[model samples]
Structures are given as structure tokens and as C-alpha cells.
Target: MADDPSDQDGALSRRRLLASSAAAGGAVWLLRGLVRPGSAHAAPGAPPGLPAGLDVYQRAYENWAGEIRTDELWTCAPRTPQEVLDVVNWAYGAGWTVRAQGRRHGWAPLTVADGTPAATRVILLDTTAYLTAMTVDGQAADGSATVRVQTGASLESLLAFAGAGGYGVTAAPAPGDLSVGGALAVGAHGTAVPAVGETPSPGHGYGSLSNLVTELTAVVWDGGAGRYVLRTVGRAEPDCDALLTHLGRSLVTEAVLRVGADVNLRCRSYLDVPAAELFAAPGAPAGTRTLAGFVDGTGRAEAIWFAFTDKPWLKTWAVTPDRPLAARAVSGPYNYPFSDSLPEPVARLAGDLVSGAWASAPLFGQVQYLLAKVALTGDITDVLLSGTLVQDVLTGDVLTHLLLDGLRSDLWGASRNLLEYVRPTTLRETANGYAVLVRRADLQWVVSRFADFYRTLLAQYAARSEYPVNGQVEIRVTGLEDPSVCGVPGARPPLLSALRPRPDRPDVDTAVWIDILSLPATPALPRFYRDVEQFLLGLDGERATVRVEWSKGWAYTDTAAWSDQDVLTGAIPDSHRAGGGPGWDEAVAVLGRLDPHHVLSSPFLDALLS
Candidate 1:
């Protein structure tokens, strides 16, 4: 399994060249191919009678991990919010559907379904091309500030802008490439909950990023005008609740989000923690380094356990006004080069798995684990262990080179640098995601139960000589939505957000997010995910509830995801409808009112949202 020296050298050179070019080019990479031609009528696949003066072209559609793809369809970029409204009106009149296309960094079919024909009456509105505009407004007396930003702006750009003004969000999704509108559409979140001694900061929320939205402007139907119009709604408005996390059922043009003062953070990575000890039952030995213990100490942590591995890579981030001596100071995001660019040997193993080497799942898992261990800690003692496939892949030369590159075990920097690590260059894997709402005391219990069931289920699959998972299990915890943090009176939680608090279970203040990832089209993955979903659905019984992470896979059948009728029509909607709160039903009704013509929706959303 050892990689050829020449191939390794070439791969390293290519990665270095890419990194250097990216640094030099800056945001040019995101803005490439965004130019609008003078004549849209001449463009291929351009439908007749489309809105004039818009950039129109034929663009193929692909989601994150390449799970859903389609041939070239009619696409356009609107330079202004009024143009967006015009496009929606045109689509509504022409019997066509308009799906807002961002960076396409999502797993769900909310934007466009797979196998959509080229001639289908669906036009993609490319938001990132022309709608990216952001400006910081005045600061408030409560140490909070607001930023008015268009939906097409990337999260990295937004944070960088905020950071320049000494403000930042408490948490955000790891990938910096995600568009702000796309992130809000899915109610994206990061791992954080209030620690034992931590105090709430004004304008800072530990829930999904959507909770920070104080006001948003979206295209909604105007009954009196009988057309779609750009309407601004405040958080206090009941209609704003549905627009906060519309799940692609509505198109948001721009938003005003509340933010707080910036804080530096030190992120420490640990690769030696045994999964058994870290996820042990609640009443374990007093000194055991458990997941809950880390959360109690820092309030922000994430556990990434590669499939079939014994130890998980646990990362804990603590707020540190000043950098510690042992921590390396980083000035920017995506600090983990080892993860952003895979080593040649690891890439080869992944290729082998994709080429149908099913039995290599165990070896793949171990290689991934060892790769992280060496990359983060510079310790290759595990790789030196005799008679293992991992040793063969992570040869002494690879370990030496990785160690020479330097360790990334501890890093301290601005919150944005430490919080955002994922890059578009990382391995593309499909995932199944969920959020389990439970009391803080039951966090350990939920982790233990999931770990036990996952281990058992994986073993059974292996025993039957079927390997489904090739990636890792990611676990993160966050606080439920608390609208007061937005500093808007009478504001309510996002009705469709998975982190929405259950009114009846006031004590269930935390949400434990669990995601299982694997290569796309892996045999038997659907069945494996089905089992996991069923287990989680009933994990805590009356004490907790499970909700689907909107952007990832869910509602599984033995053959595919989003196919289970019961989970889609019953379990999912019921989770929000429970406690008789104004959630699922209300959100659905409002979304219907906003887009009564359904110009912004696709067939998948029509079925799921209905």
C-alpha cells in the first residue's frame, strides 16, 4: 500500500502549487465564470420571454459530494433584488420554477432533484455571481451590531468583514465556502453550548445561525398587487419565523444579522482518547475523559470518529483572549493542511474503496485514524505497530514528511480562524445528519447509546461481509434556539429549524448533533443509515426528540434516502408539531402564503413541505 516516491512528490508539489495560487488569487476563485454576457438571447438553453438584462446561460447542477447531478439547465444571475423579484414573477407567469443556486455546497435535493431533464421548466438563479454585497451597520448600546448582507455572500467573506469591525458570530458551519443564504436556508450550526461557568453574551446565540437573523428581505406574494414583491420582515413579525429557515421553499434576498464582539479561541486536538472511555455511560469512573467533561470545560467541542477506529479525533475550542505558549498562532482559517489536502497514500486507499474493495473498509478506517494521529500529534508509534495494513499505507517516509510539515495539535487565533477548518478541497463524502434534543444531563447518555448501537450495527454489517461506511461519525452539541439573543422583542424561534426548542420540554436546552458520513454510492449504505435513523428516532423515548438535519440525508429506505413515506409525511412533521406548538403547521402555512404560486419550490420540496 506504500505510495510510489515519485507519485508522492508530484502530489505534494501539486498541493503546494494549488495553495500558493489560492493565496495569490484571493476571492477570484469564487468569482470566476461570473461575468454576464451582453446578449442573453443567444445563450444555449435560454428560454424565450425571460426577464431582460439578466445574465443567462446553461449550467449543469451538482450538489456537495456529487450525489445529485443534472444536465445543463437554464441559469441566470440577477444583479439586484428587484431583478430577483422580476425573475420570480416571470417564472410564476411562465409556468416555471426558479431555484436559487449558491455554491451548491449542500447534500439535500432542496434546490434541484437528480435526473431533472434539460428541458424541464426549472431555471437556476445563480446568487453568488451578482448578489454578494455586505455592509456593517451601527453598533448598539448592548454591545451588539448588525450587518446587512445579501444572500450570495460567502460565510468567509461575511466573517472577515465582521472581524475587521471587531465583531464575530459565536459559531458557524466549518466550511468557509458556504453562502450565507444557503447556510441560513438549511439552518446551519456549529458545536457549542454554554459551559458550566460561562455567561451569556449579548447578541450571541449558541443555536443555529438562522437564529441571529433580526430582519430579512425576501420575495413574497403581494395579494393586493397580485405579484411577488420584495418585502422586509423583522424578527418580531410572525412571517419572519418561516423565512428565517425556509428550507428552499422561499427565496431570501438579504438579511440583517445581530453579532457581538470578537473573541480569540484556542483549539486543541486530541487523537489518543479511546472511544469507549470518551463515550462511556454517565456514571463512569470519576477521572475518565468523557465527551461531556470536555463540553463542561470549554462549551465548544466536536468528535470525529472514523469508522471501525478505536479512538476518535476530539477537538475542543476554548475562548482565550491571549494565545497560550504551547499553541501555534494562526491568522486565517483552514489551518489543517493534512485534512484539506489528502496524502497520496490515503487518496489511493480511497480510490481502492471506490473501485469496489469493500473488505478494505477496516483498513481505510485505520489509515484515516493514523493519518490524523500523525498529522495532529506527529506520533507515528501506532503506524509502527507490526503486521497491519495501516502501517503499509502510512510508511515511515510518509510519517517523516508529515512530522517535518509540523504538528497542528494546538492552535489559537480569531474565532473565525479556529472555528472554520473545512475547505472545498477536502474529501467529498455523503452524510446522514440529525439533531437529538435532550437535557444537558442526558448528553452523556445519548452519546453512549449512539456509540454502542453504531458499533454493534457496524459489526453486524461486517459480519455479513457488507461494508457501508467509509468516512467518520461526527458529533457536536449546541444550545436550542433562544430568540431573546437577537435583541428583538416578541421574536420567535425559527419554526422549521431542527434546533427549535420544544415548548413542553423546557428543560431540554441542548441539541446533540450526530452525522454519519461515507463515500457516495457505497453498497448497502442506505440500509445502514435506515437502521441508524430508526435507532435515533426512538433513542430517548419520552425524554428527548430527534429531528432531521435539513441539508443532509434522512427519511431512508433500504434503497435510497428521502424515500421513506412514513418518516417524511409523519415522523418528520410530527417532530415539530409535537407539544402543540406553533411550528410545523404554522411554518407550512406561512410558506404557502408567501409563495402561493410555488415559483421557488421544486417537486421534492413540494412533497416534503406539504
Candidate 2:
């Protein structure tokens, strides 16, 4: 589906008209406002006993989706690991808490709580400023290698460095801008599982990134020394399991991660599959183009279902040593230009919805679906044939420009290029996340049940003139953590990772990650999310388990997220406690022992972990 030059002139005129209309709606203004960086300034007085020469300032804190914001707080950029230790010691003795700030690309309040005042006795340690040093350590005899990287390093830089050394992880989170420290702390993950008849490569893992760590250095209290000090722990150590995914209760400065030889991947996007068939029940007739079928073929896939849309945009990635004839070769990541940068039409529609045009929710959903269809397949027929609302928003000029800008339906490149596609410029939406651990055979059942419930709930809301969701529903599948992949004897799965295997149910090896996203302030979203959470908490009965994704929103109430006391204190911990062998309680105990003074803890962590 290539572009036709015969329609260029007319498309250009139409695009100009649409662009002017979008500008009038303040689309460009909103885009600029979202991307503009916040400024920091020198504080009038530094904290008492702060280490000399440490760069300290007051800066505002804002999370990825702008759902969490704090006033100007004391922040410091330590130049070395020793400086970090010094700050920790000072905070411990001065009755203050220390929180590491890296990229601020997370949704949860693991780092700092919303509305934190400047006078609060907490300091934000900026890791990205000076601690981002990475080096390729030696390689082992089995072609597996390890890299020593500072926690402050961004995932993009770490992947680039590893890829340059002919080593790379099997999967990583979509956004490369996230700091390595934050990603590991939250047990961030990407989608992949063993394809049928496929064996995993040496040092490769399909679970959370925390499973790849072999050694880590963290700041911990020392009873003998009478203050906080640096402690290095190997994966074989029992405490290391808890440190692997500490949820901001501990601070890790550096880590040694196992990496396998780099592999090329071919990622293909499909927009023709209807949601009903894709998420069909498990017993559907054989040879259907179901989600499970795609997983069996490629092992790595993600489904993005726009709200109120039947056909979803599905992306599948396969290990490809040689470029496929139909795939476009790429050298870098963030290949989805249409999604990475908000189109004028999309921005305009989003602005309208934000400005109280709640009745346009259906149009907005259709526009998003058509945008993906045209951008991925280069087929503008649907947009051209759509009703006036879609056509007027997505004019011919915009469609032509997208086609001529080199977006492709299928792309082949290095592993990093295909794995990391979400750029920082993309529209930021608040999301609620969970990982449903079930037997591989039951993956289809889980997906189908969730899809049916979500569809019904969305319709019920629409019937009440309520439009709570303005973003897509994302679904991915991955394998549970296998400690043997770390290449360390006696290594244990991260105690707090959502992918941690259940001893009582060895058959539950696959985790189906489900997330629903929406604009930050959408009305009735909290209620919708609460209903979904309650349903998922009871899904699959005793045959499956659902655990919250730490980096995203969870613990829901009718009014807001992360506010349900029953979920925060009971259900979340119990999810990890069930079928357990050294799970939630063990992780909390170890984290508490490491930071006896609670120097690295936040109020939210204290409540949730307790």
C-alpha cells in the first residue's frame, strides 16, 4: 500500500485547511506546553550537614502523566557514589528522608508523593546529572557478557552501549528515556515468551529486567559504623532478591547485568484484525488469528485497542537474523512517527475533549483508529470514506504527509530499535497496570474474559453519557522469572517482581500484562478503573493470580487511584503472599533491615509495604 502521487495537490490543500483549523483549536499550543521543561533554581539555604561541593537546588517534581506534582523541593546532584553515601548518612542522622530522582518518567509515587511541600524533610537525589557511567565488563566462556552500569544511566544509553559491544537484553521497556535505577526498582518489563519449539539464548530472559542483575551496590545502614554505608551484594545472597525490586525502599547506585549476544528483530503491525476474533475464547476453532496464535508464532506481540474501537493495532516482533523482503530496514529506535509526535488532528481532538466536549468521545475513538490504520498500512481508503467528522479532522493533506514521511508497517533492525518505540514526546496518559499469571494454555481465556468485561463496562458508561477513557488498552504477554537465566548459582527470582513464579502453581509460567490508559483528569475514570480492578482481582478464580504493576497506577477507589486502603494494604500484598516462598513479607523485612532509619522510604511506600 504505497502512496499515489496523482492525489498530492488536492491532499496538500486539504491538509493546509485542517492544519489551520487545528491551530485555531490550540493544538500546537497544547503540544508545546506539554513538552516544555521545568526550570530549577538555587535554594537560599542548603540543608544542614550537606556534604561540601554537592550541587543542591530547589526543583519542582512532576511525574510522566502530570497526575502527580510537587512544589519546589530540595534536590541535589551527587557527583560520585561516595557523595551519594555521604548524603544518605546526613539524611539518616538529621531526621530527613532521601529519594532518588531519575528522569521522573514513572506514574506511581514511589519517589515522592504528590503535593509534597518544600518544607518537607525530603531531598531528591538527581542521578542523571553525574552518575551515568557505564562500561563493558569482561565476557564469560559461554558468549554471555556482563556490563557494570551506574543506576543514573538512561535505558537508551545502556542499550546503545551494550548493543555496540555486541550484547543486548532480550526485552526492555518501550521508553528508552527511563533511568536504569527506576526501571529496575519497579521491575519494569517488556513483552516476550518462548516461541513454539524455541529455546532461549544464553543470558537472555523474558521476564522483568530485574531478573538480569547479577550484582548490585546499595546504600544501607551500618550498625558497626554508626551510619549509612555502601554495601555490594551478589545475586546468590538472599538479601539481593529483595534489593532486585525494592520499590524505592532502597537505593542502588550500580549493578552488573547479564547480556547475551545481540539479535536482529522484525516488527510488523496489523490493523485488520477485529477485537472479537483476536481476543476470542480459548476454545475457539483452530487456525483463528487469535492473540495466542500470534504468540505461538513470534513470541513477542502487543495489542493496542483504542477505546470503543473494534479493530485494534497489533504489533508482533520476531527474531530475524536476516531481513525479510517485505520489511523496511531501520538503524534506530522510536520508528512510529505518527505516535511519537501527536498529529494536529489528534491534538485538536484531545484539546476539545479536555475543554468539556464530552459528547465527542465516539468521534475521538474513531479518529484514533483511522489514524493508526492509515499510518501503519498506508491505506487512506477508510479515512476518505469516513463520515464528515473523521474526514474533516484527518484531512487528505495530513494523511499524504504521513505516507510520504517513511512510516512503515513492517520494520527490521537491531533488538533495541524494535523493542524501544515509545518516545518522550508521545501523549502522556495515566494508566492502571496489572500482571495476570496463568498457565500458558489459559492465556486466551484470561484475555477473552477481560476483553468482554471491558467492552461491556465502556458501553455502560457511554450509555450514561460518561466518557472516562481517552487512551488505548494495551495487552502483552511474557514469561515468569527464571533465576537460572542470571547465570548465578543459587540466584533467586526478585522477591517483589510481578513475574515471580508461584511455588504452589508451577504451571503458571506466563504473565499477561493488561493496562488501561486515559487522560489524567478524565471524569469518572477512577470509578471505571475501580470496577475493572475488582473484576480482575477475582478473575480466573484460584487457577490464576493478578499482581499490580509497580510503575503504574493501582489500588483504586471510586474517586482516585492508589487510594483504596483494602487494596493497598490487603489485596496487593496478598497477591504476592499467595502460593509464596519468601515473597512480599520477606522483601519488606529485608528492605526494612537495610534502611532501619527509613531514610530511603516515602509515606506511600511505608503504607503500601506495611
Candidate 3:
């Protein structure tokens, strides 16, 4: 099913496009699912890198955040999947648990250990030194324009490679620092305004850039089945399809995907659209999105409504044809952190790295990551650059609406802040779908622009509405590209089938992400998560179910309720749903077929295989 390729088949006509409830790009994605990655892991014995050995003191100290780190980590720079499997197999015998890590840039225990026994034996199989090869072939094994990427490849390398070959990825995560594997693991994405005939959609399992991957090769451990490199019969296994959202208890090694002819991209972003005008705009493009800002040459487009602050709304965008992507400033990251608060040492490093050509990594550990964030296009790290303030928004709907009102009227007038969670939609499948939670934080910002409006809205809304719903509002959207669907011969659309790289999750089934998640133990958020559960369940249709992003701490019961079989079956098979399927028995059986000695099964696999 090659999708429609024009702006006309667009879900709407000009005037009526505003306020259109039709979630534009949603229909096409109805056929697939997307969650998307970062943070790299190192393996043992290859190159004794810094922070070597799990010396008790070192382990705790390395992860300064505490909750997100565990003693189960190794510090070697593994450059091959065999190295990954060797570590996994060794850990199985040594009774140590294992995990794959990238960048290690997350703020939470997303990759940290839980109370699981596996936590005791955890090891970090680092991929930083892995083979970073990306190749473009004239034809696929079956004959197509294919791009082959090793798990360690970078998004920038792939883009630059495609450009030289006269091709381009349909879409990619906003920033370019993330490793190819890391980015996909977290469901990273950029806000892509659908083409005229296209529809606007959410970012879920796979987005525009994801369609590129058509094949995946990985190492799987079924305990009883042992360790075997499983080759999924593409059109035969239903598990294969649902499993793409997760790497399926396996370590992804490499992938092959398709790319499209290179073409220039035109992007234009600006702000300032009245509220009444925003809602009053034509419904979203027929079935997609509505232009919400400018009335003439500047079409009413998209807007971001932040939580807290008097200024409730900020950010707007519209694209013009033939304008192409702006040439990146020759050197800007070195300019500054936009604030004096950055530690002097860090500040100095950030500026120097940016001012230079930036070809190599920084001498200091976290310094390179810090600077890379500023130098790259906005993605997870956009906050640091935008000077975004993080806060805890108590739970309440009225508070939610009030905070939004303040954002537009008082706090931030034109700037926006974003949140990124690399967890599953619901807790049951915490390893599946990653959601990039976006919202504006900090009423303190009202000190600058919308101060009075900010104070007034928060007070008014708090009094009227039940309260606020999580000082943050995770207004959700999705982008789905059916891994099962692909383009036919001779068809060249903006989104090619080669983009769907599989997703990877290398954390404990659940990890405490950061300090904010360490809420006092009490009501346990049953009510709040319930409302969220009900709404997501409500969104479930006969063929699909809505999933949440980084929902582990939202309460086990609430997550269980939101992920019930009747609710999840539409989106995922009941067999694969959780404690179901051929259950662990089938998994073990397959693992046996793949690995007879159970060489790869660790305690993590035993929980399912035993």
C-alpha cells in the first residue's frame, strides 16, 4: 500500500482545515505503531576504559543520579554483536544480568536496575566502539535502493551518506547526536507537518525515518531454547510485527532499509497566533492538521501549549516549498549556554567545543555530550539550550487548563519546553513504545513576560477545576509506519519503506528516571493514572489500542488496568500481551531452537522461560 502523495488528497480544504478534529496523519498510521532511543553501553574486557570494573564505590559514584544506576555495569567498549552475545552468555553462567547501553545521557533510571534479581547481576555491554558502518547499495538482496547500517551508526552519518547518494531519510529525530540504535530505542521524532494530501499523526513506534529498515538481525535467548540468531519469516510471524516495538529480549545487531531520492527541505518557524484564532482556525487539514497562525502567505499552523507560567502558548511553524533546510550556522554551540548559571568549568568547555570545527569528542566525559547537545538539532537536549525549567505539576484537570491558559497569557509567550520519556505506553509492556512527552514548565518564567496573567490563571483554574493534572499535560500524538507495509516498485514517495528501524529498550523492566519521579509514597497516583488509563482505553478501537509513554511509575495497578487484554489485543496480540502467548514456554522453546545449552539465558530470561 503505497500512501497517497499529494497535498490535495489532504484531509481538508483551506477554510475548513482549522479546528478539524480529524487527526490528519492518523489514518495511515492506523496501519502501524511507533516509540522510539539514547545512552550507549560498554562491554567488559575489550578495552579497559575509564570507570572500569564494578568496584562498589565506583559503580555508585559513576551514576551520580543514584536511582538510575546500579552495580551491574561493565565498562569495555564492545565493537561487535558477538562481543554483546559473549557478554550475555558469560553473564548467564556467571549469574550476572546484562543490558545494552548507549550515551548514558538519560536523567532517570530508565536504564537503571529495579528490585529484580537480575539487577544484582547486571552488566553494561557498551556499543560506543562498535562497528559504525553505513552503506548504500544500488539494489537490495531482492533489488531495491537499500541503505545498510550497523547498529552503531550515527544519524548524521546516515544523512550525510544518503545526501551524497542523492537520497534522504523521509524524517529523523530532531537532533543528530544520538546513535542510530539509541534514537530508535526511545521513539525520537521531529514535528513533521504532513504533506498536502497526507495526514498529521502522532509519534509512536515508527515515524518518517523509521520506514527505512526492512530487516533486523539480532541475538535472542529463550533460556530453554538457549541462544540462537533467529531469522523471522517476514510475513509469517505476528510476534515479529509486535516485537518490532521492542527488540524482543534480544540485542539488535544490524539492519537494512530503503531511502528516497535526495531533495531540498523548506522549513519556516515563527510564532504569535491569538487563542480564539487558534481554536477558530479551520479544522485540522481535512483528516490531518489545520494552519493556526497566519491568515495569508503564513498559514495558521501548529502551536505548543506549555504547562504552568502565565504565558500558556508558544511556538508556531509553517513550511514553504523549495526553501530547503537552512545551512547550519558554521559555528554556534560555542557561543554560549544562554545563561550564566552553567558551571564555569562546563561553560568554558561548551563554548570552546562549539567555537571550533567540532570534529572530535571532548576530553572531559560529560562535556562532549553537553556540547554535542548545543551543536545538534533540537531533540531530547533542546531544554538545556532553550533554558527550559523543569517542575512538578500536581495532578488536576482544572490546573491543567489553567496552566495552559497562563502559558499563553502570562508566562512564556513564544518559547516552548519538551519532555522525553523512553518507557512503554503502559507499564505491562514497559519495554514497548517510547513517548517524547512535551510541555512547558516553570511558572517562575512569568517573571519575564506574562507574570500577572500567569498568577491569575493558576489561581483561577486551581479554584474552579478539580486541581491540575500532573503539573504537566502530556498532550499526545502518534506517527505509525507499518513495518508490514512497504512501497511497490517504481514508487518514490517522501516516506520510503526502508526507514522503519526496529526499537530497542536496554533498561530494567522499570527504572526510576530522575529525582522528580521519587514522589512521596502515598495515594500512589491511582486516581490520576486512572483518568489517564480511562482516556487511553477510551481511545481503543476495534483494530488498535492507545499506549502511554514512560508509564512505569504511574502505579502498577493503574498500568495493569490500562493494559488489559481486551484493551491491548487490538494493538498487540493476546499471545504476546504479558504472561500470555505460548507464555514463557514458547519463548523457551524458540530459545532452545536458537540456543540449545541455554548459553544466552540470564535470570531475566529465566523469569519468562522457567
Predicted structure 2, TM vs. truth: 0.94
* Model 1 C-alpha lDDT per residue in residues 1-610, reported as the tens digit of each score: 3442324423222222223322332111121122233445234535768888887877667676766767567788899999998888999899999999899999989999987877799989989988999998669987889999999999999999999998998899999999999999999999999988998678788999999999999999998998999999999987999999999999999999999998999999999889999999999989999999999999999999999999999999999999999999999999988778777777767767765687898898988888888999988777887456777778878788889988899999999999999888787788999999999999999999999999999999999999999899999999999999889999999999999999888999999999999977789999999999999998756878999999999999999999999999999999998777899999999999989988989899999988
| Per-model TM-score versus the true fold | 0.93, 0.94, 0.51
Off by over 4 Å in 2: 1-44
What tens-digit string does per-residue lDDT give for candidate 3 at 175-215? 34446665544334443323334432211122434334455
User: What is the C-alpha local distance difference test score of each model?
Assistant: 0.88, 0.87, 0.33
lDDT of 2 by residue, 1-610 (tens): 2332323523212223223333343122111111111333334566788888878777767777766667668888999999999999889889999999999888899999888887899999999999999988779888889999999999999999999988888889999999999999999999999999888889898999999999999998889989998999999986999999999999999999999999999999999999999999988887789999999999999999998899999999999999999999999999988877667767788767765676777888889888888888889898878889898889888888888887689999999999999887777778999999999999899999999999999999999999999788999999999999999999999999999999999988999999998867788999999999999998865778999999998998999889999999899999999895999999999999999889999989998888
- Which residues of candidate 1, in runs, are more than 4 Å off? 1-45, 386-388
Q: Rank the candidates by TM-score, best first.
A: 2, 1, 3
- Global Cα RMSD, each model: 5.3, 7.2, 17.7
lDDT measured at residue 416 in model 2 versus the true structure, 0 to 100: 97
